[model samples]
Target: MKNLNLKSLYRQIEREYEELRRLNKRELEERKKIVYAQIPEIKEIDDLIKGIGLASAKEQIMNPSSDSLERANEGIVELRTKKEELLKNAGYERSFLDKLNSCEKCKDTGVQEDGRRCSCMENRLSRELYNVSNLSYTLQRENFNTFDLGIFSREIHKEEGISPRENMDMILKISREFIDTFKINNDMNLLFYGPTGQGKTFMINCIAKELLDKNVNVVYQTAFTLCEVMEDQKFRRNEINDIKYRQLFNADLLIVDDLGIEVTNSFTAAGIFNIINKRLLGGKKTVISTNLSPNELTKTYTDRVTSRVFQKFYPIKFFGEDLRLK
Candidate 1:
């Protein structure tokens, strides 16, 4: 969590809560307008209720008595009951005029009455953390619930001695286990090496969605994009690139997809090594999916990078025909 800029996050969430409150008020006003137009009696009841609350407050301050408060509460309840009956008779819900709240637990305020952040706020944080990519939209269609095993071929592969569907089923179980054990810092890193269009990226997306739903900070980037972030920070240092660069090391989980697709040179190789080695040393987990085999990966990058990857990462081989062609 180094240099996470929590103050900025708090400010953003506060603005979001303000917007939510404004939206709720606007929606309530629209509802009130429609209700008042249809049943003017309801508006009269509402005005009476308001009057009772104001009068009760003044009476309590002046007389300092409980009886006045009780009487005011009784009057308000009676008026509300009549309003509900009228709305019900007019084919409206009993609570149709009630103020709306997107999250009733926090009243859309992003914080509870007890001064703790709401679950909704955590969801927002997770979304904001990875808003650089189309993660929100991609995750919607690529999560575990949408995973289709039938699309994989059932025919046996000559080399692996198992059908693609069966292999994917096993991989799916492993992916689920990775998510289940994600909270524990067991130094579990996954390297999914396979040909393109074989569901490696899709599997990575599935794991990411599950973790993000649980409020884990997951950073997903293509290998090329990750290198660009490194290059940007190294050559053109700025606050934006600085934040993105730190996130590479600070995120709970880092997913480097399409590893071999990026341009490889001395700097890119060193960048890859630094990310992998740093995360490993810190006990942070990383998952890398690549089209290159272990040997090809070694030739494409430095020996140090390949050594760390092979030693620290649990290699998960994804093999099958191109699923897109199927």
Candidate 2:
């Protein structure tokens, strides 16, 4: 998946804040007009408040006495008390004319007074990630809570000596533990490999959702799509594709699903190795799911690539009848 342009994303956030401010201002004006129409005394009270403010400014410039400032403040308060009473009698709240900010803390500015990013900004980033990952719809249907243990047969397998449900139970436990303890610098990678329909992709989705909910940066791509992006960057040399290429390596968690399904060639094989090797060296986590067996993986990729996979990734072999059929 293409990474979102950071500049564009922040620009969009600014535009949203501007739109929210505009909406709030418009709504407050319209509501105040209605209130003034219903209670003409509100207009008079507001005028008095403005007059008091102007008088205080002039007094401060002319006399600059603490007594004069205190009296001005008391006068403003008295007018405000009357205004509040009139608003209450007119069936409106005291702050009815105030700006209705979507986020009261930041006043819909997406930043706090202390210069920290607000939750609204984080939410906007998450929304952008959802769009970039193209997993918004899938995540709704596939998460840890929604995973059905019943779908996996409980009967013991003749060869593996474990039921599908029992094996999945263990996998589920490990997945949960991984999410709870995930660290950017931890050398924890996962390789979920098995035949199709064994719920590998579903499990991957569950992990993705868990990490994403924590506001962790995650870039998910099918092996094919990843290779396509790499190929575009290698040949086309486009600036945008280059940014996406860097993002694949820099994401907190990179999930490359269906690893052996991409159109493998010298370029793709090299690209895959570079991604895995670089991310591992950088201590970034990755989760790769594939239909290839251990031997097939060794034969298909370079020895260095296979060696890193064996050393770095916690291998989880999925073996069960294709759940999609059920």
| TM-scores of the models, in the order given | 0.64, 0.65
Residues 245-323 of candidate 2: C-alpha lDDT, one tens digit per residue: 7777877788999999354588787787788888888888899999997778877775576566557888898988888
Error of model 1, residue 300, in angstroms: 2.2
Name the runs in model 2 displaced over 4 angstroms.
1-10, 16-130, 261-263
lDDT of each: 0.85, 0.82
Q: State the lDDT of candidate 1 residue by residue for 54-146, as single tens digits.
A: 999998999995688999999999999999999999999999899899889899988899998676775566556557346778889999999
lDDT of 1: 0.85
lDDT score, candidate 2: 0.82
Deviating ranges (above 4 Å) for candidate 1: 1-11, 14-129
Among these predicted structures, which one has the highest TM-score? 2
- Top lDDT prediction, candidate number: 1
Error of 1 at 239 (Å): 1.1
Instruction: List, in order, the clash count of every candidate structure.
Output: 0, 0
